[model samples]
Target: MGGGPDKEHVLITLFDPEPKDITGELRRRFPHFEVTYVQVSPSRKDAEKAGNEISDDLWKSATILITLFTLPAKPELVPK
Candidate 1:
């Protein structure tokens, strides 16, 4: 699980261009790592839609979590 790209899972939970853009760049730079975007909001809009896109399985497998303001209400929801 602590291995390199093959075991690494990158979870992008940032706003706007960051989540969308960084996911693409990371996928290009490290094809072996599982890179995904969650399109997290700043609590202004679309948080629910983005939250639905992320599953508990995805959260559990995430080795690297890049996020801004979006976070789960309970830490248990996104255990590392």
Candidate 2:
């Protein structure tokens, strides 16, 4: 909702094989919000295959992590 990661940071990973440009869509949908897409997979298949291989840096910066794929996330991987 704000201009930088300090106020709002969202990590989104889509699970659709042919994913839409969600970042672009979110920006369009919420033009007032300074939405940033961090480490989002290029495609649903890529996200699904990546599993919980998410990096520590990504988790550290993300205030909220939303995964479109139905994989079970490791508790340690979740942001506190």
- In candidate 1, stretches whose alpha carbon ends up further than 4 angstroms from where it belongs are 1-5, 17-21, 44-53, 77-79
Off by over 4 Å in 2: 1-6, 17-21, 28-49, 70-73
Please state every model's RMSD to the true fold in angstroms: 3.5, 5.5
lDDT tens digits by residue: candidate 1, 1-80:
54353778877787766545656787889888887676666674666556665787877777778776555555676655
User: Which residue pairs of candidate 2 clash?
Assistant: none
Model 1 clash count equals: 0
Q: How far is candidate 2 from the true structure (C-alpha RMSD, Å)?
A: 5.5
Per TM-score, the best of the predicted structures is 1
Error of 1 at 36 (Å): 0.7
1-80 per-residue lDDT for model 2 (tens digits): 32253455566654444234767786677664444343446566666446556666655555556766523255565444
User: Which ten contiguous residues of candidate 2 have the minimum total lDDT?
Assistant: 1-10
Instruction: Give each model's whole-structure lDDT.
Output: 0.69, 0.54
